[model samples]
Every structure is written in structure tokens, then in C-alpha cells.
Target: MVLSKVGKKINDYATLVMFSHTIFSLSFAVISMMLASKGSPSIHTIFWIIVAFMGARTGANAINRVIDAEIDEKNPRTFMRQLPQRMLKKKEVIVFTAVCFLVMVIAAAMLNPLCVMLSPIALFLMIIYSYTKRFTWTCHLVLGITSAAAPVGAWIAVTGEISWVALFMGAANTLWVSGFDIIYGAQDYEFDTINGIHSIPARFGIKNALCFAALFHVVTVILLVFVGILSGELGVIYYIGLGIISILFIMEHRIVSPDNLTNVKIASYGINQIISITFLIFGFVAVIVK
Candidate 1:
């Protein structure tokens, strides 16, 4: 009976944090790790990196849920989420977030001094992102920057120093995530506007917001191409992966528009997952074959 109750609680927490969404940023982090190490980082490094990512991401999501609970409750589309629906209490989530951050710091300390020192900045970014939507339409960009830390942090974990390739990887992640977030935000446009929550779609209209998303993605692809060229370790396979990604991006954009966003969930989550996994495979192969 006790075990079952524990299992159910774990499931509830996972749902609260959308734990599966960890893949969205994790694949990019691993790709950057491989590139930074030229496919040769120690197993110790890999383990701690994954742990750190999970800790930070889980904590960030938990706190985001807590911070946005009222807004989420008011937004029809999000009213069913765990927090707003009361599947988990606010104090429970707060404790979970605190534990996650502690784990993150411990994992960082196990990795390297630089990672340990930078942990606070990462925590700050994660915490601050939840509040951005209340104040600025650039919230999507803030999210992108926050997500960029994953790849950049992974690179630092492997190399102990920042590099040009790391910056390019971070930039690519920033734009890619920002672009997709804009599309996702389209779903909440009306709610956001009604609640005075700033978002691109609410501020600029859905059609214009989508245009901005496309422009951001275009820059994302270019930045990725630059990452490949500048890394000098990635080549044909990597570019081929980018080709597939570009096609997916086009398909994603085609699926949703001002007139029809019925497929936004499919375009945002489903296609983005495939894109991230594709990059992970091709990126690893590119690093390995070189």
C-alpha cells in the first residue's frame, strides 16, 4: 500500500513538471557535450551532466508551475494542469523545487568548479522565466535564453571553458526554442490578452507572431550551420540532419497559421521532439565519424 502511494505521488510530480518535456532541451545538451569533447568525454562527465540537467529542469518546471498557478487556473487551456487542478499542493511543489535545486548544485559540484560557480546563474534564469510573461512580450526569448543554458552548460561541463562552438550552439538553441515557443503561445493568445499576460501572439497578432517565429527559425538554421562549420568536427551527416530539420520546420510552420491552429500541439510538441532526436543522432554520428 505504501509503495503504491509513493508510486502515485511520483507520477503526480512528474505530470506536474511535464517531465517528458525534458527531452526538448536534453538532446541539445548531449549534442553539445559530444561536440565539446569531440565524442570522448568521460563517463563520469556524462553522468553528472545528465543529473544536473534533470535537477535543474525538473526544479525549473516545478517552480514555474507554482508561480503560474493562478494564471494557469484562469486560462481555460491550462486549467487542467496538475497545479491549477489541485492534484498537488503548492507547498509540495515548493519543497520539490528546493530539493531539485539542491541536487543540481551537488551534481554541478561533482562535475567541475566552473559548473559549480555557474549554478546560481542558471537557477536565477530558471526562476526568472516564470515571471517574464507577466511583463514582456519577449517572454519567449527569455525562455529561449533559459533553455540555451542547457547546451551551453553541457559544453562547459565537458570543456571546463567556454568556446566559440559553445556560443554558437547556445545561440541556435535560443532561436530554435524561441521560435517554437511563439507558435505554442498562439494557442493562448486570447487568454493572454484578456489577462494582460504579454506574449508575441497577444501583442503582435497571431499572423505577425507566426511571421516572427519563422524569422527566428531562419536565423536558428543559419546559426546551426555556423556551429557545424565552426566546430570543424561536424560535416555531411550534420548538414544532412539540418536538412531534415529544415524540412520539419517547414512542415511545422505549414501545419499552423493564423486561420488554423488546430494542429498547434502536433506542430509544437510532436515535430519538435522528432527534430531534437534527429539532431542528437546525426550530431553524435558526425562527431564519431570525424
Candidate 2:
């Protein structure tokens, strides 16, 4: 009975934080880690990188749920989420967030002094992302920037220094993430606009917002091409993977329309998982073959 109760509680927290969403940024982080190491990083570095990412991402999402609880309550689609439904108390989630942040700091310190020094900045970005939607229509972009830290942080963790390649890859990550996030936010358009929650869909309407997402994704692919070139990994395999990602991107937008978003869940979550996994696999192979 006790074990079942513990399992249920764990599942609740995972749902609260959308634990499966970890793949979105972790894929980019793995890409940079492979690129920075030219194949595979030290086992110790890889361990710490994963730890840091989990800590930071979990904490950020937990806090975001708390901050957005009221808004979630108003959105019919999100009303049953743990925080909005009161399945989890704010204090419990906050404690979880604080512990995750501490874990992030420790993981960074274990990686390197540079990572440790930048840990606070990374934490700030994580915290700030939750607040951006309250005031800015460009919150997707803000989220992109925050999510960029994953890949950039991985590069620094492996290389112990930043480089143009890392920056370019980070930019690509930003655009990719922002593009997808815009798609995801489109589902909340009516509720967001009614509640004064800023979002691209709320600002530009779904069709135009999708167009903007497409543009961002185009730039993302271009920036990725640049990453391969500048990073000296200009292999056909990488381009091939990128081509697949582009197709996935197109497919993502295809499933959702301004008038009908019946496949929003598939577009937002299903295809995105495939994209990230494909990119990470190809990145690792490209690095090895280079």
C-alpha cells in the first residue's frame, strides 16, 4: 500500500512537470555535447551534463506550473493539470523546485568552474521564463533563449570554453524551440487572449502565428547548416538528418490549422519527440563519421 502511494505521488509530480517534455531540450544538449567532443565526451562530463539538465528543467517546469496555475484553471484544456486541479499543493511543488535548483548548482560545480560560475545565470533564465508570458507577446522567443542554455551549457561543460560553433548551434536551438512553442501556444489562443496572457497566437492570430513559426523553423534549419559548416562537421549525414527535421517541421504545422486544431496534441508532442530524437541520433552519427 505504501509503495503504491509513493508511486502515485511520483507520477503526479511527473505529470505536474510534464516530465516527458524533457526530451525537447535534452536532445539539443546531447547534440552539442557530441559536437563539442567530436564524438563522445568523458563519461564524467556526460553524467554531470544529464544531471544538470534534469535538475534545471524539472525545477523550471515545476515553478512554471505553480505560476500559471490560475491561468491553467481558466483554460478548459489545462484545468485538470495537477496544480490547477489542486492535486498538488503549491508549497510541495515549490519545495521540489528548490531542491532541483540546488541539484543543478551542484551538477554544474561538478562539471567545471566555468559551469559553476554560470549556474546562477542559467537558474535566473529558468525562473524568468515562467514570468515572460504574463507580459510579453514574444514569450516564445524568451523561452527559446532560456532553452538555448541547454545546448550552450553542454558545449561549455564538455569543452570548458565557448566557441562560435556553440553559439551558432545555440541559435539554431533557440529558433527551433521558439517555432514549436508557437505552435503549442496556438492551442491556448482563445483562453490566452481572454486572460491577457501574451502569446504569438494571441497577438497575430493562428494563421499568421503559424506563418511566423514556419519562418522561425526555416531560419533554424539554415542556422543548423551553418553549425555543421562552422563546426567542420559538414557531412552528408548531418544534412540528411536536417532534411528529415525540416520535413517533421512541415508536418507539424500541416496537422494544425487556424480554424481547426484537432491534431494539436500530435503536432505539439508527438512529432516534436520524433524530431528531437532524429536530430540527436544524426548529430551523434555525424560527429563519429566526421
The TM-score of predicted model 1 comes to 0.98
For model 2, where is the 10-residue window of minimal lDDT?
Answer: 228-237
lDDT of 1 by residue, 136-221 (tens): 99999999999999999999999899999989999899999999999999999888888899999999999999999999988999
Instruction: List TM-scores for all candidates, in order.
Output: 0.98, 0.97
Off by over 4 Å in 1: none
- The per-model lDDT (C-alpha) reads 0.93, 0.91
Candidate 2 local lDDT, 132-233, one digit each (tens): 998999899988988999999999999899999889888988988898889989988888988899999999999999899889999999999999889896
Task: Give the clashing residue pairs of candidate 1, or none.
Answer: none
Pairs that collide, model 2: none
Task: Kindly state the number of residue pairs that clash in model 1.
Answer: 0
Candidate 1: global Cα-lDDT? 0.93
lDDT of 2 at 20: 88
Global lDDT of model 2: 0.91
| Per-candidate total of colliding backbone pairs | 0, 0
